[model samples]
Target chain A: MNTVVRNEKYWLMAAGYIGAIFLWYASVKWLPISSFNRLPDPLSVIREWLSPDPSYGISIFTSDYYVHIWYSTYRAFTAFFLAVLLGVPLGIFMGWNAKFREFSGALVGLLRPIPPLAWVPLAILLFPGVEPAVIFVTFLVAFFATTMNTLVGVRSIDEDYFRAARCLGASRTDILRDVIVPGALPHIFTGLQIAMGAAWFSLVAGEMIAAQYGLGYVIWEAYNLIQYPTIVIGMATLGIVGFLSSAAIRWVGQRLMQWREESLGLGG
Target chain B: MEQVMKRDRGSNNSEGLAPRPEFGKLSIRNAGKTYDPQGSAVVAVHDCSIEIEAGDFVAIVGPSGCGKSTLMNVLAGFDNVTSGEVYLDDSLLASPRQAPSPGADRVVVFQNGALFPWKTVLENVTYGLLKTNAMSRASAEEKAKDFLSRCGGLDKVMRSYPAQLSSGMQRRVEIVRALVNEPRILLLDEPFRAMDTISKTTMHQHLLKMYSTCRRTIVFITHDLEEAIYLSDKVIVMTTRPGTVKLELTVPLPRPRTPEMTASVEYMDLKKEAIESVHEEAKKAFERGERELA
Candidate 1:
């Protein structure tokens, strides 16, 4: 009964989106709702995206769309990967050790609250290239999100687990491996999803200023050239990419933490 | 059939030849623990002491707020005594400078079992072996499987996580985990408190078998008077609040205590005595709390 309701719910959601698209297409194509008419019609955006570009002679099928996508993807992923690689261990270690927490916590505290976009000027000034600058700004956003969440993950573990490990003759390293890491994994995965979104968010913002080639750069460029349809294309691409990347992270998390999923019946 | 019997005999021989764990006698001398959480002070234990035989099954029963769990925490080395000392034979077990951390030699099977939720039954069982660096992974798995099978749960629960099993089954896995360490002393703090009567009885039987085979000193804490009388060789009753040993009654029932023994006169008498001691302490505890409130 619940599954049936859930299936109906998803169908309703899809219909809602379809209805929204219909409304937008109708409003722009027929109704001259002055303010809404100023925006590009979804149909024109779709056509321009699929058909050859007027200025560059490229479309969704061509390598041109992919090149912009690849630039954004590659930079965002590089930053996110570096964040996870550095952040998870650093977070876990800080969580486990008080001395380390006291030493590094001040710097983390000072930097983390600063908005991802706020660092754009600093990142641009520090790094020589546009690629490195954009990556740096996005990296800070994902890194802070991942690290803080991973730290909270470590702290949230039950005290029973630590005592049990000690009783079982676990050393510091053994407890970290067998208890802390696996215990905090569910939270780490959640952080990764959050971090992925933050990465894309700041990546787009970063590319608006820094990069030569990427979806964000294209959006800025299109806006400057007053290509309304192309602007919509860039935004739609960012939305799709962001949603897919977060979904991918969630999928990997579920796969690795199968025991949790099975217990909660989280899997389909 | 011959091959099976041959393997069994070989295992039996190996078990017999394995060095018996000879843990020193446990002694708690004038131990006291005072809690100073926030500004208020709560004295959980004060001048409480007891001597436990090397292989004896001892049960501590007391009123609520009597610090029974606190005492278990002290013995398990999870908490330090605020004053006095606990000793293993001639050596002091704890120090002011370094709080005594729990060792593999003293395994505690907590009330909740504390089985890692992420680990399978076999993995949880083999965890101690791996942590202690006692055996290679293959040997640990083989040995853990043997213990799990002996508990009659291997085939059904080997791959299951703690969440997938019943509370009773989780407790069995926990027991297997503790036994695998071959600990000298087993501390069970209300381990079967959450189980139904039938499950409790089953656990008591399993525990007895494990005790006889391992010959580890067992200190079990419980609120159930009948359980205390049924299981322990000596049952200690404690006073409430700033708890101290009130009474130590020796149960004279012979080895291999049966459920039928619950109906016996001796069992009833021992139960009556323990109940009487605990009731008085509980009344005192209530009065004490009332006085403080007033």
Candidate 2:
């Protein structure tokens, strides 16, 4: 009975999705073209997408597009990896040791609220060129949230776990590694997911400022030239990239926290 | 029945009848623990003192919020006492001891079992052996398997995680874990509270059997009088709130106590006494609270 209900729900979802796509195509066909006249028709776009002209669509993929994608991906990943390295330790330190929390906690609290985009001017002033700007913005976006979430995760661990570890003759370092790290993993992943999205958003805005290559730069350049298709493509690429990256992070999180799934009653 | 017979055969085959000191005597003198200094102090255990003899099965009974757990915490070296001290075998337990130095030889089984959720059943049992350099991994595995077998052997569930087991099964794992360690003092904090009556009775039997064989100084804490009466060699009844020892009643019942003994006249009388003492403690605790609020 439940399976039948679920089957019907899936069918309804498929129908709705198909209907929405058709409606979008029909609306685009009937709508009068204006400033956004370069808006490619759905069929034409699909045809162009399939049998693409190198000078038009495929050129975006070849020239500097790869480099731009690489640059953006690199910045996002570097910032994320660095955030994990720095944020997790700081979070653990703040969570485990009271004195460290008392000292560094207020500083984190003060800096956490300021948006990463707000750092663009500071990044420009501090360093030269696109790389520094992107890095700075990504770091700013990723660090605080990861650190705060990690702190919360560490703080919320069961006291019994700690006691059990201690009684088993676990060293302070062992407790941190074996008990605290695994205990805080779920929350840390949550922070990473949030930080990744923030970093992606910040990267786009950061790229708009002084980037020579990137999806953000492509969109900005296309907008200036009134080539709305390129702009739309850039927007679509960003959205797809963001969705895929978030999904990838969630996948990794699910694997890492598989043991916690039953306890949490998640993904039933 | 076959397993019990096998255990009997094994015991007969091994060292005859000399009792091994599973855990040594634990003495807590004037142990008092207070949380928060300036901020509305909550005194858990107030100048509480008790001596648990070697190989003695002891139960601490009290009303809810009676600081029974606090006393257990202090004894386990998990919490610091504001004043006073705890001594095991004449050595002071001021802080968590460094490895290789078996000061008190203690292991605690928590209310929730506190089994590492990440670890398998076998891994959890093998944890205590990991701390000591006394045994190799293979040897430890052998010893752990032996204990696991004795304590209703972990079947396919040996590889299973703690989250997979029933609450009773989890507690059994915890018991096996503690027993495998062969600690001098085994501290249990309402370990069987979550189990149903039948399971609880079965656990009590298993505990008595384990205790008789292991001969560890066991400190069982609970709010249940019947449980205390059934399992303990001596029962320590405690008052509530700023808790103190109310009375100590020794069970004259024979060792390897059975469930049938719970229905015995002496067992019933002891249960009555314990309940009455706890009721008085509960009344006084409430009156004290009312006075404080007033």
* CA lDDT of every candidate: 0.85, 0.77
Residue range B1-294, candidate 1, lDDT tens digits: 345434423432243223234674789888888999997888999999899867778899998899999888888888988888888756778645547779887889988778998888888988989888659999999888888887665546888778877787788889889988878788998999998999999989888767656667789999888898888878999989889999998787655678999999878888888888899998998898899899
DockQ of every candidate structure: 0.59, 0.44
- Candidate 2 ranges with C-alpha deviation above 4 Å: A1-13, A31-41, A54-64, A261-268, B1-23, B30-36, B39-47, B82-85, B94-104
TM-score of chain A of 2: 0.86
Model 2 clash count equals 1
* C-alpha DockQ for predicted model 1: 0.59
True-structure lDDT of candidate 2: 0.77
Candidate 2: the clashing residue pairs are: B23-B184
Evaluated at residue B214, the lDDT of candidate 1 is 64
The best candidate by DockQ is 1
Task: Please provide TM-scores, in order, for all candidate models, with all chains considered together.
Answer: 0.89, 0.88
RMSD of 2: 5.2
Positional deviation of residue A220's Cα in model 1 after best superposition, in angstroms:
2.0
- Reference contacts recovered by each candidate, as fractions? 0.68, 0.33
**What tens digits encode model 2's per-residue C-alpha lDDT throughout A1-268?**
9899999999999999789767767667766766334466555544433443633443343555567677778888888888888988999899999999999989888888888878888888898776877888788869887999999999998998888877777778878887999889989999999989988888888888878778888788877875555665677678878888899989998887766775565645
